[model samples]
Target: MSSTANTTYTTFTGWVDPPTDIRPPLTENFTCSVAVIGGGLAGMATALRLAERGVDTVLLESDFCGHGAGSRNAGQLASAPGGDIQLLNLLYRKGMPAIIRLTENAAGHVESMIEKLGIDCDYEAVGNVFAAVSRGQLGRTRRIAKILRRAGAHVEEGTARELGIPHGFLGGMREIKGGIMNPGKLLRGLRSAVLASTVRVFEQSKVVDIVRGNGGVTVETPGGVILAQKVVLATNAYAGEWDITPKRLSSPMWVTEVETEPISPQRLAALGWTSRSGLITQHNIMENYRLTARNTIVFGVRQIERAASYPLPERHPDPAVVADLAKAFARRFPPLADVAIDRTWGGWIGITSTWLPVAGTVGDDVYYSLACNGHGLAQATYVGTLIADRIATGITPDDLRTIWVDEPKFGHAVPMIMGRLGLRAAWTADRFNDMINGSKRHAREGFATAAGGFTAPA
Candidate 1:
């Protein structure tokens, strides 16, 4: 259970090794119809769409494409929107239907893209579960499921036994739309398609400044400049580095993930994880667990780190955080309590001030879409395509309007309440509830303990 001793701390994702065909940096000036500033999933999708539509497009990145969260997420293509569902309904109740529709469509887009690109990422249509660790959390799941169903989302709620998830979880809700896949593999597939497309891609090309001029926008880089009719800022958390980006656009949060050593198939079967759907607990800051095709369990995100300043630096998972995650993993999967951790990594993601993804124009000819709030695996890709469609055809689709803000101005990032002390408070509250639930269960039945000197977090 001591994860740090045996785990390899990696600066990059453990899902797939870095690509070898990294395109060279931009060294000369160029002109294009649209220039995408960032080569993550959103930027790549935007440029790909533009190229397919015969629009001359260029994508610029600080590093190679998919070097960010595109390759580093938990790989759960969520059908439900990110953030607390109940709160979203309370505030933006009228817009819930459109939001749900957009999310389900986003997941579908990823599924279709996977098939169209022929990306072998071990994709499974087994939708993810909003699993509960305690009775209160279970009730919350039921309420959220009702909210989602009323909003036209396909959702089902059941007990752990009925849902076919690990017994440690109580009754929870499952979104029937989205599923899981190897995100790095999917990203690599997109990268390959982009490389083969007519769109110009400049890897290692960091955009330093953006200036609007007569009938054009100038994007300045260290080694080159790009003059474009329009510019799309798809940098996500890194958007704060640019002054042109609206103030308080989003707050950057650093989250960690770890993978365990492969477990025997028989042992995995013993856990009664028949559905094999990815599980995300209903805590304020949720923890995600999924069984990989390689027979290893990948999990993380019980705690998150905040960025102190812009232009985020590359970093590895904190040792303490990894050890904490290992403990949590043991409690959730007691059957695999002793499984050694293989590797750990972390990545940066943007959390919006409004807790909803946003897209709008900063000025004439300057468009932006960002902060999918951890649902970027599908939402970002879909939103990117929508932005491209709007730019290429000069018409805004209804799906794009659902998340579009009339003004780019944003208030304080209240979601940052999940930062530092807020995160610790939430964890403490979850543990306290677990203790209460465990005591009540022990009183009803007889006390039982797990093997390997570990007990489930009831």
Candidate 2:
């Protein structure tokens, strides 16, 4: 919190846009022990960890840091994956212990990094609300909380009355250790720490090809090339991997988030986040949100139609889409429901077929880590740590084989079948669910009742 540190933290790297400023571009080829591609949370974390190991590292990013999903997101620092406990434990049975440890570890990693590097980002570790928007989901969420607690996790249930929200939520679980954040600021802090070390980072550096050899791996780029003993593809949506296998393990996904002008303190207090961690639920296509320091709400939802057909929009959040989402948000928080949304944006992230992060080396020398599924803030920090550990200890990660196992990813054969149709269907379905369920008279098990229909309000 020193003035010097604040000046450095707010040093404003490039453009002072809503997203964090861009770091300088990587213009020339360089040699290092590790080369991290992509400048988001994953890339920065990997580069920082590599530097900590005293390994020469260079990070290449197509755009400036934080411009990607890491900064473009709504800044909710959640600890859990986006699936049910049964599904996660079943698929990652071997890695279950690691997964549990990871949930807690990710929260710790954020705290530790802020302390060690003097990061001034507004990092708060409040609990997250796994809210149940419907009665059926309430039962399901309670079961999930029990399993998580049995597995040594911390999650408890709360009702709408307890949280001071509407009665739509029959009941939901609250993860005390979960939290929210300013993702752009967090990424900025990491980038500063990265710049301070021997680790070199190149912005505007796009890798074109990847070649592995006995000595190390080489990543070819436009202006230059990166030669290193090991390479990590922290790139998510744009994996930048020429190897067909790594490409198959990942697909691009898009999601939208909106931020309103800071709400009044009284209005914020009404939302009932004693610690202000974040809010989410157990619904299959649920919405998780958080209260930022400025009192703006950062809300997000998953995009359907699968990741395979997810098209990268040339623009930010679509106009009508943002307006509808903003309106739905206002309906949820009546006090500031009318608050004008200062910003509306969308981002592309990688989602594996199973919707879990796939991190592990493809071959001996070529290391690939990606498909974060929105847990990049936490998972990327850990994966970066893993990459560094692998490089330092010289260990083959056979134990993590299942976690990174690549199955062929297939998209719909219809040519761009889902551009506006699918988005309208999902966005409308979710918002309509919220609205219809928002009414007490109609709010039974919204998702399971005859009203479980996900159609938007006509």
Query: What lDDT would candidate 1 get against the real structure?
Result: 0.88
Indicate the residue-level lDDT of 389 in model 1: 97
Provide the clash count, candidate 2.
Answer: 4
lDDT (10s digit) by residue, model 2, range 1-458: 00111111111221125434556665676678778887778778878877888888888877676667777766666666655567676666666655666666676776787788888777777667777766556788777777677667777777766653433344577776756777778777777787788878777777777888747787887888778877888777777335523545656766667666667888677655554557675544556667777766766564433444323444455455455556556555545655666665667766554656677666666666776777777776766666677777776344234355444344431123234575557556665665566674344335436665553211
Candidate 2, RMSD to the unseen true structure: 7.5
Alpha carbon deviation, residue 93, candidate 2 (Å): 5.2
Which residue pairs collide in model 2, if any?
A: 25-203, 26-203, 126-277, 330-337
Candidates in order, TM-scores: namely: 0.96, 0.82
Span of ten consecutive residues with least summed lDDT in model 2: 1-10
Give the CA lDDT, 0 to 100, for residue 115 in model 2: 80
Model 2 misplacement above 4 A: 1-24, 90-95, 161-170, 302-314, 396-458
For residues 35-65, write the lDDT of model 1, one tens digit per residue: 9999888999999999999999999998899
lDDT of 2: 0.64
